[model samples]
Target: MTAADTFETILEMRARAVEDLLGSLLDERILPGEIARPARLLQAMRHGVLNGGKRLRPFLVVESAGLFGADQDAALRVAAALECVHCYSLIHDDLPAMDDDDLRRGQPTVHKAYDEATAILAGDSLLTLAFDILADEATAIAADRRAALVLALARAAGAGGMAGGQALDLDAERTQPDEAGIITLQAMKTGALIRFACEAGAIVAGAPAADRERLAEFGSAIGLAFQLADDLLDLTSDTTTLGKTAGKDVAAGKATLVQLHGPDWTRRQLDGLVLQARELLKPYGAAASTLKLAANFVATRRK
Candidate 1:
């Protein structure tokens, strides 16, 4: 099969695994130290998370860890935890106070599926559940490794990372940020978790710090590419293809690199970023082929 097809197969398999794991994780099984899993809240969380998407962050976690020969099962658990955090962000992002979206992954958003209050609690629950999974013994990783994962994830998902980026995005609507400001905001908002997803594999396997740094750099490059591509799609693609609202960025007056530099320039930047990401993965040789494709995928994804 062609490389793209191969990558699709791998990605599909991993996405399915992550999806099933997330379902089990969200199930109403009263684990230790948990009081009660409210039915409505659990349903909201499931609706928010189980709805289909690429599951790219979790895929990165698993694939990055694979480079270092990390345990597959352990990697899956870590991937699930990261997916939880990602879904939680989507849940909160769709709130009336935030993006105020009615659709997500081509389905009703959590708030629309349930109630606003339930959606808020569901997001909170998913965010907290991510840490719990990372810290729990079920992950079957070393204590130090687990601790490292937890800390890294917290930093990635917290104010200095994704949340901070969202705040900047909200502010951008009011005051247009300069080029540098836009870059910084994108790095923290979209790039942070992608960076963590790549580096977490090294942490999972206890790989050398240098390797971790290398993967992180690769992630940073592709992370920028991902957002650039997304911006391009926002301007070009329609809602039917994008699953989410298309042109929402422009409608909301959000500042984006695509808006500033134009589509031609953004495409060139994506090419450069993909090349940089590929170069970073050269040390792993053929084993890095999937990751290289992933970089290309991030740059060229239609949705």
Candidate 2:
């Protein structure tokens, strides 16, 4: 297979693995003294999370953890927890007050599949479940490490991170932001979780501060690369290929690097980002070959 195809295969395998792990958890999600989970809430949660998503954040968690000899099961659980947060965000992001997206992962969005209220609750449930998974001793992480993971996830997903970025995005629709503003917005909105994905591994494995900083830089560079690639795709690709509504950014007058600087400039930026990410991995060498390839994939992915 080509490099893109190889990377795609690896991503698919990881996505499937996470999906299976999530399915197992959902099956046994019931806790003591509970008759059964409310069917609709559970169903909505499953609907929002399963049968869709690349599980990219989780993949980073697993790969980064691998670099430091972290336990496989612990890495997988952390990955799963990250996925839950990601899926929850997607569900909320599709709400009418948010993006009002109807399609996601080639299917109706959660609010469309179920009612808006149910979708909201489902998202809330998934978000909380992410923390629960992290806090549980079953994840095999030490208590202190678990607390650190929870703090990191909260910060990444909360006001100072993704939510803050999104607030900026919403306002940007009314008043456009400059290129720098766009960078900050996209970094927080999209990059926070990705950075967490990389950094979480070092935390789980108890890697040194320097290694964590390097991985964070790597993730931030690639995260920017991924967004630039996505912006290019939004400008050039069709909805079918995107698995969601395409061309909405332009329609919404969304402030994007592509809008500030045309596709040509954005492509150049993506190239630089991929190079930077690869350079960051040089210290780890072949251990990061797969991740290096993933960086390239983010830059070139059609979807």
RMSD per candidate (Å) reads 1.1, 1.5
User: How many pairs of residues collide in model 1?
Assistant: 0
Q: Of the candidates shown, which would achieve the greatest lDDT relative to the real structure?
A: 1
Per-residue C-alpha lDDT of model 2 across residues 1-303, encoded as one tens digit per residue:
887788888889988889999987777468764578888889889999996577888899998998888998999999999999989988999999998888786688889999999999999999998998899898997898899999999999999999898899889978788988999999999999999999999889888999989998998998899888988899988988887678989998887888778998988898899999999989888888888988888788888
* Native-to-model Cα distance after best TM-score fit, residue 53 in candidate 1, in Å: 1.3
In TM-score terms, candidate 2 sits at 0.96
lDDT of each: 0.92, 0.89
- Candidate 1's C-alpha runs over 4 A off are none
List the candidates' TM-scores in order.
0.97, 0.96
Flag clash pairs in model 2: none
Provide the clashing-pair count of each candidate structure.
0, 0
Model 2 stretches astray by more than 4 angstroms = 32-36
In angstroms, the error of model 1 at 101 is 0.8
Error of 1 at 266 (Å): 1.0
